[model samples]
Structures are given as C-alpha cells and as structure tokens.
Target: MKKKLTGKTALVTGSSRGVGRLVAIALADLGCSTIFCHGRSEASCRETARQIESRGAKAVILPAELSDPAQVESLADRVLAAGGVDILYNNAAVMHPWRDSPEELSFEDWAWSFQVNVFALVMLTVRLLAPMKLKKWGRIINLTSGIDKTPQLAAYGASKWAVDKWTDDLAAALAGSGVIVSRLDPGWLKTDLGGPNADHEPEAVLPGALVPCLLPDDAPGGSFFRAQELRNFSLD
Candidate 1:
C-alpha cells in the first residue's frame, strides 16, 4: 500500500493501551514505523507491537520505568540505535490516587508525580533532540491534560501545566530548525487515567489530535491545541 509516512519512525511512550495505543496504531497505519514503550506490562506491549506490525510498519517494544532516570536514558539509547527517532510522543505520566487531596499529599508523592510527568518527559526530550536537530525534521508531541478543575488531581494538573509552558518555550527555541514542538490536550476520555466516566471514548482523539503531528516543516510551533482543533487555527 502507498504510505504518507513511509520513511518516518515514531516513538510513542505509554502506548501499551488506551489513547496512546490508538495513536501508535494510527501512526503505523499511516506507514510510520513505531517504537512502543510501556512500563510494567510486557504482554501488553507485545500486543500493541503486534498490531502495529500487522498494519505494515515495523514495531519495536522497549519497556522502561519512566520514574527512573537511568531507565529513561537506557530507553533513549535504544531509540537512538533505531536510526534516530523522527517523531516523539510524550504520553507517559503518573497520577497517583493519593494526590487527590493536597492537604494529605506528602512531599514524596508530589516529587514522584513530577518525576514522571515533568522531569522524565523533559529528560527524554533533551536526550533525543540532538538527532532530530541533526536530521532537521521532527515532531515532538507532548500530551497535556485539560482537567484544570480536578482538585484531587492537583499534581497531575500542575505537572501538565508545566509541560504546556515548556512546550510553548521549546517551540520558539526550535523555530527555523525544522523541529516542531506542540502541546496536545487529548480531552477527557475513557482511559485508565481518564476513568470510566469521562465524556468521550479514547478513539475520539484521532484525526483531530493527530493533526498537529502531521503539520508541515514550515508550520509554526509552540502553539497549544485541543483534540478538536489547533489553538491558533482561526476560522476568520
């Protein structure tokens, strides 16, 4: 089959299931080889890789605990070994239940949440940026959360906000360099993280959420985006 992303390769973290899984599948279907990284579940990771391969894109499964910096570095090495990652989907995050109450949350809890959601995400991006810059073409999609009102999810929300701000800044730093960085809010969806009561299904993120990652090299970055539309795409 003819492919739009024939030579590209995408590394999607937390892709063993839910929205990340669907995104990986969609990228593979578009003809981009995929690298699936998921923590704690080898079976699930294998399953996702199998699906990606079945769609005709090569699949690589590399499991690494995001909370650990050493593991994150190891994963980066493996990704670099794959001839450099052209697309990076920062979809992994930690949202512990204890974070539901700020008064009851401990310093350790907050630190752990930030470690996975912010530190590791930033670390992995820093580690991988060199190759993308050298190649002069790349897409870095950082997933953001839209539930700002969740008092119980303070850590998650705050960390996401940090990433959103970082994405905005990174876009400016990467301008004219052929590397695009954008924040994508997938909206509240039915996933393990989103819970069963979320208004939309995980599949709802497709077509719309995928648009930013598919933008042209000359497209401006550091923009915010909802799954439904680019934050800066004016209808007027």
Candidate 2:
C-alpha cells in the first residue's frame, strides 16, 4: 500500500521525547522513509529510532547541542552527507530558567534561547536549502509559541518571535520555488516544557499541527497556523 509520504525523508529536531517524539512517529506512520531524530541524549534518540522503526520507517539518531555552533554544524554536515531530506521540522527549542522580567532575565537566558530557537534553526535551514531548492520540493515547519507576553518567559517568547519573523521572510523568498515555509504554533500543551498546568495534552497537537507540513504547492505561504487554523496574529 502506498502511503502519503512513502518516498519522503524528514528531519525532526528534538524528537527524543514529548511532542517532538510524537511528531516523528506520526511522520513515520505516514511512511516517511528516513527520519533524523535530534536530541542531546543518545539513549533517548535510540529509543525514538526504535519506535520509528517499529512504524516501519527508518530512524537515524542525530544528536547535537543546538546551543553549540560547532555541534550544530556537525549535525548539518552529517545530514548533507546523507543527502538532504524532503521535510525539515525545526521543533527543538529551549526555555531557559525564568527571571521575573525581561530586564532581570540574565544574558545567559537570552543567549541560550536565541542560540537554540533562532540561530540554530536558521543555520540548519540555510544548510539544507541547497538540496531542497535543487530537488524543487520541500517543507519547512518552524515550531512556535503563542503571541502572549509572559514576563516570566520573556526570553522564550522573544526567541519564538524571532523565528516567526524568520519564517515569514523565508516563506516569501521560497514562494513558487516548490518549497514552502510556515510557522506552526503548537499551543501550550502538557509536555516537559509546557508543564502539567497546560490545558491540552501532547496528543492534542496532532492532525492540525501536521496540516501545514503537508500543504499543497498552491497553498498559501507565510501563514501563521495555530494548530489547524490559520491565524492573523502579530509578534508585537
């Protein structure tokens, strides 16, 4: 039986556990042949790979500390050597220890969030673009959070906004080039980062969250999606 994504290969970052793990499995279940699972722990990545293989898909563990430029470059080199993938899910991110306010937020917190959430994402995408552009087919889903301003999570929110801006521009640049870029706001869910107080469960992100990743060529680009719905929201 031919599946929707049978011939596709995907790189799902931060896929060791939580929503990242679920997303990787979902893609695998749909018949993605090669799934690159990124995380800090080799054991977790191995577990994710096992689960992906259980779905009859190939899983390759790609471990890297997104906060480290050298490690990120190494990861990119490996992916390029393996042949770039058809889909890139920039799901990994960091929410550093909170400070009372943005002003109180230590430089380390701001730097860490941006390094992982913003800088690493850009670096990986730029590295993968050559293959995607040449193949004339690709999907880049940049995971983001809501627009709400939480003083406690100031750096995190700001980092997400940066990605939001980046996605918007990249979507426009890739328009009509057979590659689509979009922002996916997964909403606050009960995950390691979201905590137990979150309203929804990790599974609640399914179906809708995956929608933008599988968009048709003619589908609107540069759209901000909140789960399944396209939103007209702003970072400011």
Candidate 3:
C-alpha cells in the first residue's frame, strides 16, 4: 500500500512491551508520523516515544487500564484531542489463572477477562466510531488467538472467541463505512503472557501484525489472520 498513514494517528495499547511495542515501532517505520505509544507507565511511555522519535516519527503517550470503561473513554478523548485516532491496535489482553480448568476458573477470572477483552473493546470502539466514520476511513484490529480450540487456556481462548465474533459482527454492521474491523493472532509470541518458552518471538510477527491495519480501505474485512498465514501481504 501507499504511505497512506503518514499523517494519520495510530494508538497501540500495551505498547510499552513485547508485541504491542514492536507494532508501534513498525508502524512508525512505515511512515506513520503520529503514533500513541500507550502503556500503564508515564516513564515507559516516554521511553517508547523516545524510540519512535529516534526513527523520526511522532509519538503520543496515553495510559489507561484497558478494562476500565472510563479510562478507555479518557484514552479515546485524548486521541481525539490529538487529532483523532485513525488506527486502533487493541493488542493488550489478560491471561489469568493459568491451568485452572473451566469449572475451577473463578467468577473473578471470567469477570476480568470480559472487562479487558470485551467490555473495554466495546467502549473504545463506540467512542472512536464517530470520528472514523466521519473521516470515512479507519482501521481497528483486535488481537485474538488460535487456541480457542485447544484445551489449555480455556478462559483465554473463550475470551478471544468473544472478540472474534464481536469483530465479525462489527464489520458486518458497518459494511461500506470505510472503517475496517479485523482480528489478528500474533502466533503465540513469547511475552509475559505467552511465557518464555513460546514458539514465536514478538518481533517475528511485527510486520504481519501491522498489515491488517494497513489494508486498503476497499479491502475485505472481518477475517482472522495468524502472522504466519499473512505472508501474502508482507511488504518485505
């Protein structure tokens, strides 16, 4: 695609570390000047901003607990004030109480998953939809997983499945609106949540993770992509 996002603003959550961080840097490298390098820390955000700026891209820092509706609203507001969010990377997620069987997983686990995975997404999407819709162009990507079929990580899988369905529904609801909705599975990267021994590295999938966001506005939406399966679109 073109350097279409050069002047656009992109916000990436949990971008202070790992895959989210890599995506932020990658988008900057692709000539997107304004990127919101978001995390839970002022210090980390500054550090992320420094790195992006070193690459000659502008970075904004907006921090919030992804699960909190009010915080998500505030984040959207900050992005709007910064000239609206053109791309949204919902890359942050929770993998709580590992190894707890479905029945053994506490109500708290369920609540927390929905809070971060589902509710916060709805809130943020709701807030940004108007701006994106008006601009007649935007990209929204939700990071999901392939293990929704696996026995392990039952709760995490279930939550991502929710995200998958939600993304598809949103795409259908807004067909022809120019706002694209898609889901990305970053191929089980080795992060704090993915564990140290995981099969993939965060950097390995950075380019593919950026693709869904960079898809042309006329391209199809509501599809699922694993980084390994997205080589067809790689600019490299």
Q: State the weakest 10-residue window (summed lDDT) of model 2.
A: 227-236
Model 2: how far residue 135 lies from native, Å: 0.8
lDDT winner between candidates 1 and 2: 2
Q: Please write out the lDDT profile of model 1 over residues 24-55, one tens digit for every residue.
A: 88888777856555654677788888888888
Candidate 3's TM-score reads 0.93
| Backbone clashes under 3 angstroms, per model | 0, 0, 0
TM-score of each: 0.92, 0.94, 0.93
lDDT of 1: 0.81
lDDT of 3 at 196: 89
Q: Which residue runs does candidate 3 get wrong by more than 4 Å?
A: 1-4, 149-152, 231-233
TM-score order of candidates, top first = 2, 3, 1
RMSD of each: 3.2, 4.4, 1.8
| lDDT: worst 10-residue window of model 3 | 147-156
Report the candidate with higher lDDT, 1 versus 3: 3
lDDT values, one for every candidate:
0.81, 0.86, 0.82
